[model samples]
Target: MLRILFCLLLAAPALAAPPAEGPSPLWGMLQVIFGLLLVLAAIVGIAWLFRRFSMGSMLGRFQPARVVSGVMVGPHERVVIVELAEEWLVLGVTSRNVNLLKTMPKPAGHDAGQPAANPPFAQWLAAAMDKARKRQGDGDK
Candidate 1:
């Protein structure tokens, strides 16, 4: 046992020294960094491919079902209005479950052949402001 201990003490320093045939520290570090960068680039490339291909219908261009509107009632709960098959459905969604609240008919003037006529809020606001300014200018004159 004493001889074995002595041999181990002598061999420890030899084992601790790096092997001369192995890569240098700087080269090993560079390889690790390049490997990590390659992995990162692969991940980003996959994401870009998914986006380019429009995977999982994520672009919202051709969904058969869509959320018309939603309102948050709590941190993890919402009342969502969904449109499906030209019918509107109100749903109560929480973290635990989704419950159907009501089924509503499509609103009047929402003709199947015509797109919705609602203008963007910014455009509507600008028109209203212009009308108000004209009114004020006329009153002042």
Candidate 2:
């Protein structure tokens, strides 16, 4: 019985010998990294699904209401024209509140098929430069 007890004590120490150095620090870090990656993947997948189904119009590309034009009135305020549901609205927008200033019918001849009345600033600048160059050449001749 004494010999058996000693052998049992020795066997217990061997059994509890720290589990073969457990897991390395690198293995633990890898597990944490993989877990974070999995969480990120889940978040991205949910966002993609939401975008694919067009669940949130504010986040999606298409919108029923759009800003036709806007101009800054103050440092933090803007006067904006919005087009919605075939009606035009002039709104006073500040950082704190948005107020409807006026409502008007959609303007005639404002069809999307019509080209803009004014070209971009860059094009206007280029045309002015070309005219100046032509004038300079004419004066030289």
Q: Which candidate is the best by TM-score?
A: 2
What candidate 2 gets wrong by more than 4 Å, as runs, is 1-21, 24-26, 37-62, 113-141
lDDT of 2 by residue, 4-122 (tens): 99999989977884855779899999999999999999999999998877756656465677777666657998767788887888788999999997888878768743433333423
- Candidate 1 lDDT, 1-141, residue by residue in tens: 999999999999988968669788999999999999999999999999888888647665767876776766579987676778878887889999999978878787665545443344235445866998999999999
Clashes of 1: 0
Q: Rate the local accuracy (lDDT) of all candidates.
A: 0.77, 0.77
Supply candidate 2's per-residue lDDT for 68. Answer: 74
**Residue 12 miss distance in model 1 (angstroms):** 28
